[model samples]
Target: MSPTRHGWITTPLTAGLIRGALDLERTERGLLPHRLPARARAQCADPQLHMAESQPSGVRLVFRSRATAVELDTLATKRVYVGAPPRPDGVYDLLVDGRPAGRACVTGGATLTIDMATGTVEHRPGPVATVRFTGLPAEAKDVEIWLPHNETTELVALRTDAPVEPVPDQGRTVWLHHGSSISHGSDAASPTTTWPALAASLGGVELINLGLGGSALLDPFTARALRDTPADLISVKLGINLVNTDLMRLRAFGPAVHGFLDTVREGHPGTPLLVVSPILCPIHEDTPGPSAPDLGALSAGRLRFRAAGDPAERAYGKLTLGVIREELARIVRERAAEDPHLYHLDGRDLYGEADFAELPLPDDLHPDAAAHRRIGERFAALAFAPGGPFANGSG
Candidate 1:
């Protein structure tokens, strides 16, 4: 046990105790975990990228403790689109000895309100919210407090009746993955339940998720973030965001993919790298995108997305899931000839047509909680099984 803070043992929030976050900012109130570094954040002025990266998807506070009670102080910021129904507050999950022990939510904090139709933004401030968990086994065991994957939370403090010790590395492979919002834990049950998080558990690896929502547009900054981070295995799940934003055509995309890969190779030239294509989204499977929210559904307190592109635009070099997959597979094939450690994975294999019928993407763009589990299981079987690309370390 350590010195008491207000009658309870306390621990300083430090980088070593936080996992799955590339950077941590010492904010005025507390420490804030960020998936991207300061340099990468400085390169982008977009509010969306800032919000997504700040929402700690796979980030968690892990330690070894025997305390029967634990508490965390946080200042969480939630988003509220003026017209659309509000999303649920982010959930905090506690795992004891690698199994779930408790779950809770912060009651009060700040809010960011946006009027999308008018392009107006509003911020409302609030007080710190404390998430508490009691009734533990009262024996020494590892505890992992997974942050709310959908909320921007600043860690204020952590307190327990017993001292918290640093968790020794398990020598597991560290898997660093980057992708769109689906990879960002959208619509998933909670932080640890995100597909990538689940996949990491089943595959027995440490996770550093860079799955920024609506911001994975093959930006050089994001590629540079991936390049610099240390990892034992790496994968880039691309194409969805490019098509979702209707950002570019075939000509621009091909070179962008090559450039992103080239940047990552500069940091770890021989590390095994996997390129993943978009999963099956019926609306974007054949049609082009710039998917728009179903405003009518939103008026009914529902959230859904519809492709806003012209199907005929495919002939004009517009991109779709099918086209992206073809090009990604081709690119990996060509690159693998010279870079033996490079590989490709079809997202369809992760969530294919059959799986869709069984559990469809409720938002038409993001997978639901159950689908997240299914995809995680499938990914573990594919990538962690014998002879898989990431079976080796990132080195």
Candidate 2:
């Protein structure tokens, strides 16, 4: 039964073969990965968070094998807007012994279409598809298949020409990161190219990305999850999602930030923790958000975003990017005296005005693919370089 099809050996998907997900779900079709555990998921029934947490931003399948070919069967759920252009197919990247080896995209899967204006959704089911990678060296090697960061996927099946085994621990430093859609690889080309993934590669560390799209709103459970997860280094990128969602005012945000950090500290008080502020977002910098899709652009078959909140709302303590950054810096500064390991990194250093001019965010919010690469490289240089906050053994 194991070698039923040709000489391909079908290996059952298991937790040890995967990385970067907190939970594995036994779905009707296959194994679905969830960033948040079921306990945390039950606390909030928000559909957006449900979708984001299942997108597998930093999730990958890692194993040791001597196979020359591998094939994976997956069932993916892709999102579509009623009026906008069709989203590109999600990319699956193959890495052989820690290097880019091959890439392919799944063809058929379910589609969920949403009408932004009407708040309507239509679900159209599709078929399961296989993503195959061949032409590998016929020698023992570590194999990794990075899943798509922008689509929901279920691991249906795994097959290889040779038997596979769990990869031995490499003793690499573990780096955990949290943020909004940008960190979730919203506009990134592939999984490994996501800024956090790229940064992890450059820093030579293992990555645990908790970058939930539009859902990084300083949830207590998320922080608790971060608190409990094991890692040698940790960084939480805050501000973008909060501003865009208009989740709270300054009065509440300050306490929420503190509470989030407090929960994480409860678990790893000595871990080299980094608190990063919002990056340069022009629309939300001086103005408050509730960002909304640009209806005019939508009519023209383009997807764009615009700030919906009034700038004058700042008088009411409504949070803006500029306000949040200042507050984050001050909070870190005040807390650092008592907690020596706490640190803050201005998000602007990752993407500033000059970088914006050169590579503007295509949707007036999320960075484009090129910007993702630039941000990733810059983060690696600043955070992992000598004398940096995440520099060698700072933890």
Give candidate 2's error at residue 238 in angstroms: 0.6
Residue lDDT tens for model 1, 255-349: 99999999999997988898989999999998999988888777777778899999899999999999999999999999999999999999999
- Candidate 1 lDDT (Cα, 0 to 1): 0.91
Model 1 Cα shift for residue 364 (angstroms): 1.1
Each model's lDDT comes to: 0.91, 0.92
Residue 117 error, candidate 2, Å: 1.3
Candidate 1: where is the Cα deviation over 4 Å? 1-6
Give me the candidate number with maximum lDDT: 2
Q: Provide the TM-score for each candidate, comma-separated.
A: 0.96, 0.98
* Cand. 2 TM to true fold: 0.98
Question: What is every candidate's alpha-carbon RMSD to the true fold?
Answer: 1.7, 1.2
The true-structure Cα RMSD of candidate 1 reads 1.7
User: For residues 245-294, could you state the per-residue lDDT of candidate 2 as single tens digits?
Assistant: 99999999999999999999999989889999988999999899999999
